[model samples]
Structures are given as C-alpha cells and as structure tokens.
Target: MEKTYTRFEHYSGDRTYQNEQLVEQALANSDFDQAATQGKGFCRLLDKAYIFQDEKLSEYSIVIYTLDEPGLLDSAAKREYVLSEHDEMIIHRMAVVRNGQYLDKADDVQIRILDHEEQGGRGFLTNRKKLSLIIKDLHLQDILIFENTLVSHAPQAGLKRDFKHVYQEFPDPFWFYDRYVLRTVNQTSQVMTYKSCFFRDAQHQVIDPIAIDLPIGESYVFEADNFTTDYDPKLEVRPFIDFATKASYSKVSDAAYQIYEKVISQNSTWLETSAPDLLVELAQHETLDEKIRFVIEFVQNSIYYVYDAEIMDGHEPQEPQITYESKQGDCKAKTVLLKSLLDYLDIASTCVLVNYEADYFIPFYCPSPSNFNHVILKIAYQGRHYFVDATSRNQFGFLQYRSVPEFMYYLPIEPQADLQFREPFWHQNYLVEETVTCMVTEGVGQIDHTLLLRRQNADAIRQMFKNESETYLFNCYTTSLYYNMCLTDNFSEKELSEYFTDSKIAIVSDNQDLNELQIQHDVTLLKPYTVRIGKKEYLNYWDRTYLDDKARDFNSRDLPFWLSHAREKLTFELRTDRKINDKEKVTLQECKIDSDFLCYQTTKAVDKHGARMTIDYSVKTNAAIKGEELANYLSSDKKIRDNNFGMTIDLFEQGFFDKLKKSFVKK
Candidate 1:
C-alpha cells in the first residue's frame, strides 16, 4: 500500500499546497484497522508538528481515520482547537481536508467560535478562543486532516519580551496511533537541542538535521511506532510522562528569574499603597507569624479566585492594587498580593513557581514559564522557612499547607536560586483522637462519640461540615457505625437522635491551643452493640479488625504504593447494666507492630461491668512501599488484622426458679 501525503502551508494570509496525492492506502498499512478490530474504533493516521523559528511561528497538523463504527463517527467528525489570541501569537491559517479533496471555501466547513472561559476560575482576558469545526461528508475509510499554523512574536511588553520559549507536547501513541512524527524547525540564531523522554517500550527513532557551523538554522525529527502499555492498576502511585519537546534559552532559571525580577520591580510602586483594608487590619497582629497567617488566610479566603488571563499577563501577575480592587485573582494574582503585604511588614518573602500536579517532572525540564501551573509565596520567619499556598482555602497553620508532595520540587523565582527539593515535616501529621463510649440497656445502646482533631485533620473535618448538609453528615456517621458494628436497621432517625445526636462541630483557631477542632456525635440505637442469636445475646466491642481488610489485597501487589504519614488514636469504652462476674474478665494482650512503613498497636481490657479498648495506628513513612519492605509491611498488617480484639459477653436469662424467688421476694 502506498502512503498518502497531503501538505498545506499558510503565511501572511497566503495559502499554498504541495504533493496532493490521492493514493488509497490500505488500513493494514497502519495500526488503525487493528485497533478498530480490537474495539478501539478509531485511530490517528498522522499527528505531526513543525516549529518554525524560536517561539515565533509553529504549525500543527492532525489526520484521524475513523472506522465504520456507529459511536466513533461523531467523535471523529467534530474537532475543537483552543488558541490564545495574543499580540505575540497569531493563527494565520486553519484548513480542513476531507478524503482526498481540500475544503478551499469558507462555507465548505462549519466553523463556530466560542469563548473558552473555564469555570471555577477567572477566564483568561487574552484571546483564549475555542474554534470548533465540523467536516462535511465525513465517512468511514475516509481520512480527515486539519492543520493550523500559529505565528508567535515576542511580547511587546513584560518580562517575556526579551526571551522566547517554545513548548510542544506531542500526543502519546496510547490514543491508538500507528505512527507519529515530532518535527522541530529551529530558525533562530541560538543552537536548538532536543530531548526524547518517551515511554521505555515506545518504538521510536530520531533523525537530526545536518549540523551547520553557522547559525543558519536546523531541524530535528522524532518518529515513533506502536503504543506501549504505560499504566498499571496495581501501582498506587506513578510518575507522569514528559512526552513533550521544549525549545527555549539554555538556562531556564535565568529566563524565569528575569521575568520575576521585571514583574516585581514594575509593580513595586503599586505594592506600597495597595494593601487591602482587611489586610491592614490584620497587620495589627503582635507576632510576625500571626501577621503572615492572617495575610495568607486573607488572600486565600477573602479573594475569589478567577483566572483573568487577559488583564494579568499570562504567567506574570497583575499589580497588587488591581488584585485588591478586584478581590478576585488566580494563583498568580493571589501570590503577588500576599507577597506585597509581606513586603510591607518587612518580612522576607519570595514568589515561587511550581507544578502542583506534575512537580515530580519539573526538575528534569528546562526552566520555562510554561513548566509551572501554580504559584506560591515562601516566607522566612524567625530562623525558619514557610512555604505558603494562598490559593489553599482550608490551610490554616504555617506548616499544614506544605505537607503535599508537590511542594517538594518548588522553584523559587529568584536570580541565583538553585532547584531545591523539600521534605515534608513528619512531625506535622494531622492528629486524630476519637473517644467513643457506649452504654447498653435492654437490648438498646447509646453512643457518645467525641473527636479531637488538629492541623490538617481539623481543616478537613471543618471543610466537610461547612460544605455538607446536616442530613448528609448524619448519614455518614450512621453508615460508619452500621459497617463497623454490623448493626441492624431497627434504629430510626428519632431513636438514633436520642442516643447518637447531631454532631456538635466546633473549630478553635487559637494559635497556642492543642486541639484546633472538635466534633461530637451522641446517638441511641436498638441492638447496636449486642447481636441476638436465638435466645442468646452476644456483646461485641468496637474492634479495629476492619482496618485490616484494606491491607489484605496488597499482599499480592508487587508494585509500591503511597503510605501517608499519620497519627491516629481511637478509644472505645463500653458499659452495660447486665449482671456479670469478676472472673469473666476477658483481656487480649496488647499487640504492637513497629516498622519503617507503619506503626500500629491495640490494647483491650474487659471487666465485670464494662470494657475498654484503645487503638493507636500511625503510618511512619511518607514514601511508597515496595520489594521486601512492602512484603514485610503486608505481613505485619495481616498479623495486626488477624489478631481478634473482639470479646463476647453472655447475658444470663431469667429461669423458672428466678420467677418463684421473685414471687417470694416481693412479699
């Protein structure tokens, strides 16, 4: 089968074409038919790119060939293209090819333009437009090709005016492509370099253009065939793929620092006068830490986050005055405003750029503005450094927000700042202390539960209560008890409310206090603690056995998984009015398993009238578990789960003799 070739170019409103071949290429020549046979339904015939000049002009073209499947035609027929209409970039040409004929007239294709303002954040003020095109007469075995050439110029103003960075991400073959090509045309004065970071099993070959001694320009081509399975369900955590080519100035840090320096200096005058009244009021805090916290909270909670990309120069932040007046800004605007307030307080702070979702791969990429998705402010206070993300609404304390893994690879946008990786402070784990008491009488039990949470745990619970309705929260509590205690469905909302009352949630923000949040739930239910079998009643105490079920499935998994650092303590006290003897005391010897990955212990004690059990479970490691360590952890977890902490109490039933004795005692 001969390869069908179609090429088109448009520059300065002039359209040109070459090699318009109409060869009927066999479906078997590519992997499209095989993927269709396997129910994939459609495949990309060509996903190609061409970067002309530095970041100035680039052309991207895609050709998708759909199978004769019902559901797949709709997806393959319509196409959407997103582009930012900035003075620096222009979409010079957009054309579509159906089968072997090119759509030369405007009416040949159905084109619709829509504002691409994303929800949950402010829309970019720039020319961020979505172009939707519908191809006419699309059919199976017919090829559909769409191409657009974008010419990018240097920003007329701002930090990016001097430097140019170009980034192109090629679609992975996992989308069921038989062949893919990544071509880069570097027509700049600087020498261009290409790095291939494709998946291990991806069959690929790179062809570099002949090197010239002079800066005449060069082109690099990368081609790949077939798709390699890149995901594993067994693995709990995986590193994202860097399947893109970045062309920019050699020094990434230098380029970023230049932008940071320029933006900050330009807005320094406005920063001096643009402090919000709320921020000014918060500035009265006696301690620097308190002031910083107040500023962080103000920027995070007070300002509504909206990404106004037009007013705010892309990655560059708008003036602090504008952010204060708007009371709404994205991460960049919030970070800038927070930094400005900190500067007014004479605190040492720096704006840092980070990729919250893909921080693991940021260190490997060349430093460019496009590398980062989120921005945060770093403050140095009293012989320590605090990385504060003002965009986080629920983060209260200084160290609480830094617990996430993305902070590990954050880059400070400063002129000599080295790439530094941060380690999560293990001591800052959220603490959860739950005390539950159960009192039983006449086959019914009342539960009084109080939870004391600190730091992240407190923030999480508070957020839940604030967002969820009262009924939803009650249902959650009921669900937990139902699953843990194997409770019957005999308890009604009115009966449950008498014993297990509505949760009384209180949050304390005192900086010096030990407990930051408290939630209490008291409930009464029928046969909550006791299960009846025929005429015999058995009392089952709250057991930590349910925690073990999660680890059982991991015994067979060979891949490593993320284990969060945690410190949790649960205590249960059960008291019943049923008569008992001292000799019937049941005690399970305390079991403790301590390792690098996890630390767990449970202690149980039973007496004549009541029983007490306490479980202290903590995850000791912040890294993934694998190899022998994973096996050891799984074995220990199994041991912890296998040790039965449940004890049964037999209630004495009144006999005929007791009835006669009661008749004699009544006189």
Candidate 2:
C-alpha cells in the first residue's frame, strides 16, 4: 500500500478505470450562469450524482473552482477525500482552464494515499485511508476542474444496505457555491422512501427538508444554489433521504438477528469446551447480578477491542468461542460473546446498534441497518434492561450502576423491533461524590479532600490510576488547591506554584470489590491569610471564580449541551479552633436554590475561633437542555449565583496591627 503511493505523479488506485467521454459530458453540463465573487476563491460548479444500480450505489462528482490570491494555493492544492478499505475512488479527469482552454493534467497530477495511524491508538482496528489530490502549478485566476467517482465494495445487496445523506450548507467559505446539483437515479425497480429533518439556516430560521419524489421513472433529484458556510459547531442537523428497498423493517431486523444466532449454533463445540470453565467461574459469584458482572468483566477486561474492516457492515458476527479463545474482537464480536454468555445463564439479552456519538438523532431516521456505527448489549437483569458497552474497560457495577455510554437512540436486533429510545437518566444516585474539609490548626490551614466516584466517573478515574502515577495526580490537584486557597486573579503564577506545590494526593482505595474508587488529597496552606500587595495577609471567601468559569464555557452557545458531567454532588466544610464569635449563640447565613435541573445551597457560619462557608452543589438531571430552554437555565443559574454571600475576610487587618506590636517584643 505504501509503495503504490510512493511515486509522486501516478495514480494511487488501480481499482477504478477512467472514461474520457463521460468526463467530457459531465464537464459540459456543469456550466453556471452565476458570476463568481471577484476577490476570493470559490467553487463555480459542483455536480454530485448517485446511481442505485445492480444492487449497488455508485457516487460520482464534478467540481470546478478558481482562486484569485496566492494565499489559497496550499489549500487549493491539498484537496483530500477520506476513504475506507471498503470504498474505492477513481479520478477521471483533472485540468485547469487557462485562456479559455482546458490544460489537461489528469495523468500528471500528484496523488498520495495515506493510511490512518492514529486510529490504531484509539482501538478502532480500521483500514481507513486518505486520498490527497495535489494539483501542480495551481496559480491565481486559473479555474481548476476535476471529476471523480466512488463505490463501496462492501456487500450492500444483502440484509442491511441502503442510505442517503444530504448537506444544505458547505464547510468552506466559498464566494459562490450555489451552482450545485445532487441527484440520485434509482435504476432498480424497488420503491425507496426517505424522511425529512429540518435544519437551522443562517438567519436562525428553520429549513424543512424538501421531500421530492423521483420523476414517474422513480429517480430522486435534489438541486440547490447559493449554499452558505455554516460555522457553528453545534449546528449538526444534516437533511437526508433513505433509499433502502421497500423491505419490511421486521424482516431486516430478523435477518440480522439470525446471523448472530447462526454463529453461536454452528460453533457448538466451542461451548462444549468453553462453557464448563465459564460456568465453574460464574458459580463462584453465587448471585445472578454478580454472575452477570463476572461475564461483562470477562468480556471487557479479557476480550480486547479490535475493530476489523468488516465491523458495522451489517455482516455476521464472529462465533462466541472464537472471540473468547482469541480474547480480541470488535464491538460486534465482544457483544455477541456477551449475549451468548447471558443466554447460557438463562438471562435474556439483546443486541443494540448505536452511533455512540450522535445516538440522539437515531429515532428521527428511517428504519435501516446502515444507521448505526457501534454495537452493544442490553441485558435484562432482575426486571429491567439497560445498555452495556463491551468495548468499555474498568466498568463494574450492577446493570444501571455500570458507567456505560450515554446512548440516546438504539436499534434492537429483536424481531419486528423498530427504533428504541433510552431516556436520559442517571441510574446511580451520584456520578461523583466529594467532601472538602478545611481545618485551621495552629494558625495554618490544612485542607483534606476526599472523593468517592461511582458509575462513569469511577470507571474513568480508575483508568487514570491505572495509566498515571500518584505524582501525576498531585500535579493536577495543585491547580485546584491554588484556586481554592487564594483568590485566582490576586496571585501571580510564581506565587501559585510556590504556595501549592506541597499538596499530596493518593488513591486511598480502588475497585473496592470492583465497585468504586476513593481518593484522598491533602494540602496545607502555611500563609492562609494573604491579601496581595499588603504585608498584612488575610483570608477571603466567596471567590465565585470557579462558578463563573464553568458558566463561561456555555455563555453564548445555543446548542443543546451534552450533560456528561451531571449527577455530581459536592460538599465543602471548614473547621478551626480560633475564637471569632463573640458569644456561644451565633447566627448562620444560608441561601438555598432549587432549579429545573439542579440544586445548589450555600451556608456560612462563624464559630468562636474560625468561620466556615460550606457550599453544596449538585446537578440533578442528566437530560440535555434544548436551545429554547437555555435562557431559562442561565437565568436560574444567575439567581442562584446572585444570592451568594459577599466576599468576607477574617479580622486579619486588626490582627496585623497586633502582630506588629508583638513582632518587636518577640524578636
């Protein structure tokens, strides 16, 4: 593969042959009347067409563009397209329009095909590669034109193989990209259907998907002009049409389910050899949930995640015995094995396909096997079923307690199963529980912080300890200690590092019976009283910097924020031996806030020797807030924040005068 792309000016692929006559026809049909923007580079014409023929879908595209400035040369020359091993791309023509003439450079264009090395580190055993088209001598004011076609070699004619994707806007800031047409010709006789999803346009208005049935010949066509670039990362609705054959949803679902069952049935000898040992191991747990936990751990910890090229191709999963014996499999492979184990235990479980990232949009899509990108299992333990990812590691708990992916929509492999939805709920009470105790002993502040993590937080931190050392943990906490002990903006960088370097952190406990991780961190502040620029130092509270910092990340965005850090509860307490209260009877100030999705409260009390301000904060819900509800959430946050206590300091200024009087006599 490397050798094929080593030569600079040659074709990188031998799979697709070029047709000159077809290329000329495509170019001649791409004439645009709209004038290009004068100052910037822009695409004058783009023609993308798809043909569903002979049980396969082929994609062909033609693009013509020009650049006026030399600044756009690098970007113009380095145009690229990502391709997987299952997909083939062929370039039919490449030429430049110089003086109203086509200077053909199709054979001499520089081409480079590079494989993805980073995917290996992410545990996605993929043969995905990139194809780069490096046009040589790409100069100013010269129109560059190219034609290409793509086809997937995967078995699309089988049980699950139809899809349609659409884009209303481009990513590039082209001056004029409206001269574009996207067409699909269904050469097959099957009647394909598609659904509509609305997109938000530049004026903040919704653009509903245009559903146009193909001509009487049943060919679907979509054409658009003046497509603008969408810059918001949160805006992610891509209008699409579905072209799956009018096959029944249940039929497709059952066909895929049968393949999984067949793999287990044909490999009966595997169970004969492997089941007895697994059963003997499962028997040690004595309880059903524990037995299930054992099997899940066995798959997660024992079977490694290695995504082969065949993953998610709607193909048959490997035999359970094979995955169990090899201790390595993709999402589908590990999931099938886990499902088999549950089956052997007389536990009912089903396979689910999800897009781990954008699962929230799954139910909106038409029924098709091509929608999902990842596979997991939904186990029925006790009386309920919840998702469990086989590719996850170090996750241990009951079904709901396990820290699994926050999946929204799923397609079950059960017979007649349509799309399924998972309500956004945190099965466990607390994703993270932490207690910060500040003790003022002998005129110094000794802070003790203990964190108890469950669910996803626990699993994540456990892996942190597995991959990082205690020293690394302390370095991370140093920043936290700095912000907690001193006013953030009041201290210099050197002062922060000098004062907080003495912090100590240790993983006090881990996987306590493989359930949760408990960590302890301690920091001692020698000069707890410090008001910058004053030799007389003092303690200050109500910094509110941390609260403002967290809110700043979403101050202006309208995207439905993904709430991964929700369901966390934290408590901070301060204690000291000094006498500051005048009498035994003292007053306490408190503010309680209960919002739509969270609860927060702060209490301040002064003892005889010292004062303590305790803040209890928790995000109660896991559901994401839609854009319409964002302003209300922010308003509620403001109400809670505004009730905060004013910044207060100890009687440090008065003590500073006492220290000066005692300094001359004591020395």
Question: Model 1: which ten-residue window has the lowest total lDDT?
Answer: 205-214
Give the number of the best model, judged by TM-score.
2
Candidate 1: how large is its RMSD? 6.7
User: For model 1, how does the per-residue alpha-carbon lDDT over 1-667 read when each residue is reduced to its tens digit?
Assistant: 7211122334432223232531232233664556666655444545455554544555655454543565555765676766555422222233334555554433445666676766644433444677666656656655544445544454555544333344455443235665555556666555544443322333322222222221235666666676423534344222222212233323455666665665565534564456545655875877766776677777888888876665444566766777888888778778888887777778888888777666654554544556677788888877777777777776666543333323457667776666667763454444778787878865567778788777667777777888998887787776566545644434544454454543453343333223267777777756554436666555555455335455556642323445554577788877776644334445344678877666777777767766777887777544555677767877777766564344445555657886687669668
Alpha carbon deviation, residue 214, candidate 2 (Å)? 4.2
Best by lDDT: 2
Residue 642 Cα positional deviation in candidate 2, in Å, after optimal superposition: 2.2
TM-scores, one per candidate: 0.78, 0.82
What does candidate 2's lDDT look like per residue over 290-325, in tens digits?
Answer: 888888889998888887755556556877888888
